[model samples]
Target: MTGEKVSFGFEDVSEEEKVSRVKGVFRSVASKYDLMNDLMSGGIHRIWKSNTIARLNPQPGELLLDCAGGTGDIARAFVAKAEEVRQRRGGEPAMAIVTDINDDMLLAGLEQRGDDGLIWACADATKLPFPDKCVDVVTISFGIRNVVDIPAALREFRRVLKPGGRFACLEFSHMATKEMQAAYDAYSFNVIPQLGKIVTGDKDSYQYLVESIRRFPKQEKFADMIKEAGFSKVSFTNYTGGVAALHTGWAI
Candidate 1:
């Protein structure tokens, strides 16, 4: 894939360029990313993430590898939920490894909540640094579409999971109906970038984010991609009139 071109928010660019630009975009918005999410979705992203964690059913003593875990939202939640279960069931402690390709995002996460005892690392999704079958759960939230090689990343997610381990992803997806699609498109293409400019002073990054969501595959198609990447019993749950979705599979 050295010379291949990939979609960088509706524009065709070389893989290296896409990686560089995506890192830059995240770096630009790292400090304000969570705030932008709340503004863009009216706090609905929090619900979506909560639902995702519930469905994941994190267990005590399980290790979760949260890829592209930008601000460690999912990681913190997973560890907390698992700890809750451990307290009730009398089990070992649970842990999470929050990894991102961009250091600025990781630094932002550390600055916000570094005392949670969660491990932090810099890692590429397509080529993870962990050993095979190392983690019980793998998750990526709102970050897969920015990957230069999505299929490779999926395989890596599967690769790092132990047998019978779970994989979950939360991402922006197509709206359920044409009417809703029209309304959502008008709002997304018109308002989101301006909100980004107001909040983060970076309109282009948010524009690319919206475009990347549009470029992502539909729910069923992504489930099939997960199946093709050696996962089984793949499924997805649409959230908020399909404005976002949670996809899940098991490494078997």
Candidate 2:
């Protein structure tokens, strides 16, 4: 332990501890992750993900590296969209590699919906296993907040992308209006943990998750961070009045 404090939810913990706790949280919730996501967002998360995939505009023969890709949701969707393009035109099959630090999360993805054109690996977001400038697209959905060194991870995302390649992130973000923020806080603090307990038998994990979202940087600030990570043409679009946001940039 370098005695470096990192946010594990609202609580401060050592970087190593944060990593271990995050891994444990995912491992505990791995089996019920998708169900919890649907329940938490009232199935709107699907629409958000669909919007992300559409914005990414996955092309045939492109490679997508989905860091912190739990249960392969984004990976599967990316491959499917790319395949649609390939089938319509003529191109090589696109590949999506789903990587998460938690082994159980990877296992859950493989067990739940293993599909062709998708590869699963255990990887840390801050230190990806692949060579630099190797992938066409890099995406992390609803997962970057949990990373202890977000800037480092962002740099890694840029590092793995080929020049002109795109990077997109979908994350829970700050709401636009004070009224909306108030209402969202009420529901998030009051309701989400209970739902977690009912569904996954882990209220604490959900509590941490909620806090993590609040701790995450707001839209404009995060976009700046992406730019600072050596990406250009960075921008962000808020979804559902900023309940979530999609941030995009180019490696160049």
Candidate 3:
């Protein structure tokens, strides 16, 4: 370790070792991640995630990869929708594989969701383990912010997706209006970490949560990055006055 160090979010430490910071965070918060999310977003994350599932339009015999699938919420959501589709259209559900770098979180997800053998893997988003053009759809809800390199992850998502595959990312985004921005910041700073303390007994992890959201790329710039990753028809839909945005693209 060097005497001098660099900043990783609000803390300053380690010039060459700041990047795995997110892994540390998720490790610390893994057990209570879902509970804290419910407390922090007031269950609105469910709505945002539900909307993302809708945009996906998953069909039978398709494969879905839910990256950073912490508690398997997106996988469950996809299965739920697929079941609904099956009721009317009458077919099997799409395969939803939940992958996360943190084993603790992935294990909890596996435990909670109980398996349909819906492939769970330990992997990095920037360097996925799947073969090229193997998945029909890829979704990473609130996962990209923790990635050290956003652009590389975008390219990887595109790579794993089959031709014309769909990619939907649900992430915390810049608020649309000044008033909403101020309110969002206030709530983020004051309320969220406090909930983390009360719920997960971890405040610093939640503080980093707030900071990462602030540091994430803006809406249009991120869409541009997706396009640069060789995706086509990139677009984003801002939800709740841009507090969260769903960016969509198709691998061509």
How far residue 200's Cα lies from its native spot in candidate 2, in Å, is 0.7
Residue pairs with clashing backbones, model 1: none
Estimated TM-score for each candidate:
0.99, 0.98, 0.92
In model 2, pairs of residues that clash are none
User: Model 3 TM-score?
Assistant: 0.92
Once fitted onto the true fold, the runs of candidate 3 whose alpha carbons sit more than 4 angstroms away are 1-7, 10-16
Residues 63-171, model 1: lDDT tens digits:
9999999999999999999989999997988999999999999999999777489899999999899999999999999999999999999999999999999999999
Worst 10 residues of 1 by lDDT: 112-121
Cα-based lDDT for every prediction: 0.94, 0.94, 0.85
lDDT of 3 by residue, 1-252 (tens): 344554556666563455467777888888888878888888898899889998998777778999988878888778777777888888776788889988888988777667765788988888898999999999998888876667888999999999999999999999889999999999999999888888788888899989878878899999999999999989999999998999999998
Query: Where does the lowest 10-residue lDDT sum fall in candidate 2?
Result: 109-118
Residue 226, model 2: Cα distance from true site in angstroms: 0.3
Candidate 2 segments whose C-alpha is farther than 4 A from its true place: none
| Per-residue lDDT of 232 in model 1 | 92
lDDT per residue for candidate 2 within 73-126, as digits (tens), equals 998899889899999997998999999999999889888886555888999999
Provide the global lDDT of candidate 2 against the true structure: 0.94
